[model samples]
Target: MALVELGRFNRNEAHILIGRLDSEGVVAIPFDGEASIGDGSYLFIAVRVLVDEDDLATAKAIVESAA
Candidate 1:
């Protein structure tokens, strides 16, 4: 399945969002969470939260409701 970005957040937030999505039965993943770590600036990079393209709509709704 094609993965589409749902949003970008800090590493902790990204993982939290992934857990929320998973609880709702949507498979989600975090990308680039460790990028820039060589310089200890990983937190400066926004981690991407992605979900299956087919679940994008549902995922969006869930996230919006959480906000």
Candidate 2:
């Protein structure tokens, strides 16, 4: 994979969208999930989707639509 930046997603958001992307047959590689969104200690999940350059638009659209 070229390691394209699919998007920046927090824990709750990633947890919600990963399922939808899976259903859409979009390959996803979770980059990290150790950072907290707010001042709290709770961890967050940041994922990267391995999509074709041409499919970046569609992938972004899918993530946005789910949000």
Model 1 global lDDT (CA atoms, 0 to 1): 0.94
Give the alpha-carbon lDDT of every model. 0.94, 0.65
lDDT of 2 by residue, 1-67 (tens): 4547677676666656767777887766565565554766545345444555656777799977765
The 10-residue segment with the lowest total lDDT in model 2: 42-51
TM-scores of the models, in the order given: 0.96, 0.62
| Whole-model alpha-carbon lDDT for candidate 2 | 0.65
Query: In model 2, what are the clashing residue pairs, if there are any?
Result: none
Residue-level lDDT of model 1, residues 3-60, one tens digit each, is 9999999888889889999999999988999889999999999999999999999999
* Deviating ranges (above 4 Å) for candidate 2: 35-54
